[model samples]
Target: MESAPAQPGTAEWYLAEASKLRLTPLDDKDADPTQDPKFQERQRKIVDLATKSVALTHKNPEKKQQFEVSARYLLDARLQLAMTGDDEQVELLYENARAFVKRDPASHAAAHGAHTLVNLAYHNATQEKAPDKAATWRSEFAQLANHYLQTFPREEPRSVPLAYTAGRLCEQHGQIDDARACYTQIVQFTPDSLHGSEAERILRRLDLVGNPPPISGPTLEGET
Candidate 1:
């Protein structure tokens, strides 16, 4: 016999409902779908379902997988809403990420949440015109990067890219000390890798007042 469907209030039901509401193709590629009533309505439903699923699985240890899945969906839905230029959703995304990381610091979803924050920081810095907001995002990015580094070991694959991004952003914003700290971590952890080599070059450049000399090596004939 076939099994019955998940009950309406259960986590599985919410996830199923959310999965059913896929975005359809738009007639105009350049048109902003977020402005369409149908699109907005669908997004709202998705956000609602994802939020409910997270709540349902919050304290259920046996439902840890479901919780992570719900958190991912929640963040994704919030990100979509935030892309509509909704400040509320953007703030909620930050809150959601923080909460998720706090609840499951070592989970893949937590890492993704941190990465999402980094993306938001980049968007605010490059795309938005508000300086104060951009600064706030940068600060948050630095904080998240530090937190990730502290939480995950250097051997973790995600660590290197996060360190690189954090270092570059810090250097760009004149946080030389913070940048050096990040780059130093990369160099110490993986000195032979591409990121480590690049980090070493950056550290060398930072040590000088002006641009450092070009990197040269001996050719086959031993010519400099």
Candidate 2:
């Protein structure tokens, strides 16, 4: 005999229903999925199901695995919505990411959360229209990048990229000291890596300011 479907309001039911929605995967780099009404509808349904699943399993000690899965779904949904320019969803994404970190500072989830914050910071810096808002996000990015470097070991895969981004952002914003610190960390930890090499070059450039030229040669050909 065939098995019966899971009942509504249960974790299994939520997951099953969300899976059946068959929403398009978020992999099309050239198209905006949010611009499609059908896609948006399906996404909203999945988000709702995932949210309910998370709430249902959150306080149940026996449902720890389900809670984690549901949380992942919810976080992913929020991220998608935020990328679609939904301001409310952006706020929720930030909240959920921070909550993950607060729950377990050393967990993989915390690292993922920090990375999510970094993405949002980049979006704000590049996409936000208002100068004041962009400035605020840049400040937050600097703080979060510094926190990630301090909180996670240098061996973390994200450490180098985050350091490089932070350093570049700092340099763009005239935070020379902060930029130097970030570049210094990269050179110290991964001197042979591409980022490290770039950081070293930038450091040399920074150091050259107000100092005599190493060699009084003219600019190289095609090196305006």
Candidate 3:
């Protein structure tokens, strides 16, 4: 069982330690380290403290920064834990992350929502427990990825990753056209970059190139 919430310092230490623990293949291990009963209880303690920190600090913008970071980490831990077994908690975590993203779009908090959704989608898709849930997560991930790309400045450094994620999510959701658009945006934004190259590869694989743009822009290998 989780211990009582500690003060910020102790809570931070515990959360940090938990993050550092290495996870092995599930079949080889007795349990996911994060979902080990002892670890879960310990993480719950940190979550309690982190929740308290957010409530106490949210009104003060400067102070809110630290606790907001804590809140994201705590919720991420819970999301990971929920994915180990409980679908209901997984939904709850999704809501919490979504609420945080809506409340603070510019902050890094929003990315956690995307990350959690992607993880859940991967879990449900590969585990074969709930195909509907998997579909929902993929749809949600695509929506969030598109939203992030639209909301952020195209030239922003984060846009590159967002574009890459959007491309993958769109592809996974069978929005092939949108995936092509995302990959094309990546190439346009950063032609020589790794993500651009990867996007080009996917475009080639998908045979997304058509009669060409007529202006004769950059062409991936094997493109018409």
Candidate 1 lDDT over 135-219, as tens digits, reads: 6666666666655655666324776787788789878978787788888878887789899899999999898846667779998
RMSD of 2: 5.7
Write the residue-wise lDDT of candidate 2 on 1-224 in tens digits: 98998998789899888777644465554666657655667777877998888778767879777767776766766666676778888888888878877876765556666777776677677667887877777767666676676677743478688778878987897778878888888888778989889999999999987795766556777343
Candidate 3 per-residue C-alpha lDDT over 121-148 given as tens digits, one digit per residue, 9 for 90 to 100: 5455445456576565555555545455
> What 10-residue stretch in candidate 3 is worst by lDDT?
19-28
What is the descending TM-score order?
A: 1, 2, 3
Best by TM-score: 1
Off by over 4 Å in 2: 1-5, 21-30, 34-41, 59-62, 169-178, 185-193, 210-224
> What is the C-alpha local distance difference test score of each model?
0.77, 0.75, 0.63
Query: For each candidate, how many residue pairs have backbone atoms clashing (under 3 Å)?
Result: 0, 0, 0
**Error in Å for residue 17 of model 1:** 0.9
* Cα misplacement distance, residue 10 of candidate 1 (Å): 1.8
Q: What TM-scores do the predictions have? A: 0.74, 0.71, 0.60
**Where does model 3 exceed 4 Å of error?**
1-30, 129-136, 148-185, 188-192, 204-224
Residue 60, candidate 2: Cα error in Å is: 4.8
